[model samples]
Target: MAPIVQGTGEVIVIMGVSGAGKTTIGNLLAEAAKCTFLDADDFHPDSNKEKMREGIPLSEEDRMPWLQGLCDALKERIIAGKITVLACSALRKRYREILRLSDPDHLPGRHNCSVKFVLLNVPVEVLSDRVNNRLANGEHFMPPSLLQSQLELLEIDVSEGILQVDATQNPSVIVKTIGDSLIQTKASESY
Candidate 1:
């Protein structure tokens, strides 16, 4: 790994459809930021995992508790002033909003740490191939059959503080791009 890039209290959510390299890229970004890496999938209940393993797409009702748990976990770290990289599907704007607005009572911008989203943009073919490979190796819980559903749910807008990157790029290159982008954005914000 290259020298770690120093970072402030920031929560970076690596997001996209299944097989978009969210976990791989998020881990690398966490390493570059010298912070902890978290996989949102880990927070999923056994039932949720089973649903995905069975090629079932989770409904919004099935996701609320899970999303809330992730929000609480992020709040815990942010309040402690720790930087973190989390890989979450967060396919809908409401989901991302849940991840963003840590405290309902307080203004969105007054959170202890900033939440930035990184969307991995990959072609459908490439995503399918990656998911297939992972399934073939018994390395992932998400069934390749659900990729289309995830893609359908994905709502992206780079204008909304979501940094978009090519998922087909090397992990190192992806990490560097996200790191540089965050640094540049933060610098400009301070101006």
Candidate 2:
């Protein structure tokens, strides 16, 4: 809990479809690590929010700019040597790549930033229930109807080095799992 990877320009991305508790888990992890926490939804343009509010699925074209902005923001934090935890629905391999800042063609310089992705893998039924509950409480703009589309678009590749956590567990458990994994990963890399 004492700053997981301080001054190491580490970016931890908590990813999954809506209702997977990305924001909640990400916030808790960041707090435990004593770092910055960011919710990707806040970066969405008003148009995108409106579309989701209307139960419309956004296309790849609709997401590129937003993703790019997130990448830029993350890059800045990395350069500043800040540890940042981002909660985002980085459902696609391409989107994850962008967030990783792995595209040499677009990168301004060699950034020694370490980006770790944690996927919150939850059961569809649980996701549905969570989304529905949020909808009923008017707590979010994303309607429950868009969940299916998000699930369909989700693509995970083992080669991405993503850490998958069973999201059905309690939020604290999920955070501890991720934190332990990250610590182990960092330790291994030091060799």
Candidate 3:
């Protein structure tokens, strides 16, 4: 699923580098859609956070369980017919594939739910600014120190049906653009 996705639902995953505003915009998105908002960061184990706080990057091994947990949680909501927006640093294709398949109802035409990927593309300079602001206030784990690793893991898979947005744009404008797409998708569901 490189570009055009084939499933349906109100499951939208906001993804980007650490400082790309996933949680901020995701909250607005969840509010607009009247759905639950989940942050993947909360799913991280104590050790992972500790490692990042120490200015160390988490190996993929350290992230597997957390990623799986997020996938399972979202899958449960999809099963209950509940729509939600989640902030996940789904930076890799394989990681996303796991979440996309966690729903057993995802077989063939039976799955009327979708997992939309909205990628925020921010320049390194802008990401630095965001991280700087965050650190000044007390945010850790996403220190500017970890930025290189995030960019390294960041993959541009346009064929995966992702909506790529420039992170430099105003958050409200970005959310509105995606909101229109969500509205169109919901309207088609009643058919």
Candidate 4:
């Protein structure tokens, strides 16, 4: 596959609710783009993981610090001139804004950092099945019971310039859709 972005310092965030194949697609995308891959779940605090493991939904307060940490990590990669692909369940608009790496209050003048978010739009039934399967296989910590909470928290705004891809499609097809969208975005911006 051709490089998705021409240069380093680009961050692609593969976002969705749990079991939406964010990690799977993120790894593939990072390999295809020849960049780094960071799984947001790896950065989650133990407390957050415990809450989710117990099937208790986390509040915004439980997520702010985690989001900030991810933002910082992404910023660090950008400053180092390294491309990074992150898998994050950025369920809310505000959460995504935090991950954009351009918050003036925190990192001033870092607006030059290019961050794109691709939302994996999977049906609730598919998500539930995936989550249950992962749980049965002991592949993840999150309990299947929290899927509804995550679905409730999900908010996709058309104005956010997020690229929504069908998660039900083959992983390669989904990655290609995201890549094509990025190429088009770059092409349009050049004009």
Q: Report lDDT (Cα) of residue 134, candidate 2.
A: 97
lDDT of 3 at 64: 90
Compared with the true structure, model 4 gives a TM-score of 0.92
> What are the per-residue Cα lDDT tens digits for candidate 1 across 35-153?
89999999999999999899888988789999999999988877776778899999998898899865334355443337888899999999999999999999999888999999888
lDDT of 1: 0.84
How many clashes in each structure?
A: 0, 0, 11, 0
- Candidate 2 lDDT by residue in tens digits, 53-172: 999999888899999999999988877878899999999988877887832233432233377789999999999999999999999999999999999999998867789999999888
lDDT of 3 by residue, 75-168 (tens): 8877776777889888988887777775655543333536777898899998999998998899756778999998999886656767888778
Which structure among the candidates has the greatest lDDT? 2
lDDT, model 4: 0.86
Stronger candidate by lDDT (2 vs 3): 2
Ranking of all candidate structures by their TM-score, best first: 2, 4, 1, 3
Q: Model 2 misses residue 45 by how many Å?
A: 0.6
Candidate 4 stretches greater than 4 Å from native:
6-8, 102-113
Please provide TM-scores, in order, for all candidate models, with all chains considered together.
0.91, 0.93, 0.87, 0.92
